[model samples]
Target: MAGDSLFGIHGAALEVRAQRMGVLASNIANASTPGFKARDIDFKQALASLEGGQGGGIAAATKYRIPVQTSMDGNTVELSEEQTAFAENAIQYQSTLSFLNGRIGQITRALKGE
Candidate 1:
């Protein structure tokens, strides 16, 4: 877990974001399926649980999303909303990855006495 200390919460954050992306993608994929309720992860709660030494996976933070406008088929997966969330989560995942890469580069340089 040395990397955990080196990367801080960004590591866990990246995992949560990745999981969230999958959930959002599922929502988008199931948009047409009747009675398919969209589920999303609570990033803050997930990260906190991980940091708190809770062994539960991100599934612990997964919850059904409340649609702003419900569809007649009882499906809660809103295409526009799911797409937007997926895009935002992807951006955040990339940002976290970049930060971790930068940190690793810095550590490598320090070890090389550069």
Candidate 2:
């Protein structure tokens, strides 16, 4: 019962989101580095595969990001693109956390007969 209640799709989603945040943060950090290519995870595909009995923990397949405008230094890390992706991922992470919190609250209330 403990395991049943603690682990679910939302839990998996949170883990994936955290991983994505790390990748995006890395891209942002390497924005000015020469020849650094921006990389990102395929969130939807990874999550779907994970939920479809992939027989593994939450993980995403990292892929290089294509730049709209090529730089002379061969750096593909676009500051604006990285920033946007970071913001979107952060929002998703927070949303998943809030959902998990609400689920916990519901369970607690039920246990207390409230």
| After superposition, candidate 1 runs with Cα above 4 Å error | none
Evaluated against the true structure, the overall lDDT of model 1 is: 0.91
Error of 1 at 31 (Å): 0.8
lDDT of 2 at 35: 92
lDDT of each: 0.91, 0.82
lDDT by residue for model 2 over 2-114, one digit each (tens)? 24357577876787789999999999998889999888888876677666756543444668888998688999988998999899999999999998899899889999999
* Model 1, span 21-68: residue lDDT tens: 999999999999999999999999899988777867688999999999
Instruction: Assess every candidate by TM-score.
Output: 0.92, 0.85
The list of candidate 2 runs beyond 4 A from truth reads 1-7, 55-60
Candidate 2, residue 107: the lDDT equals 86
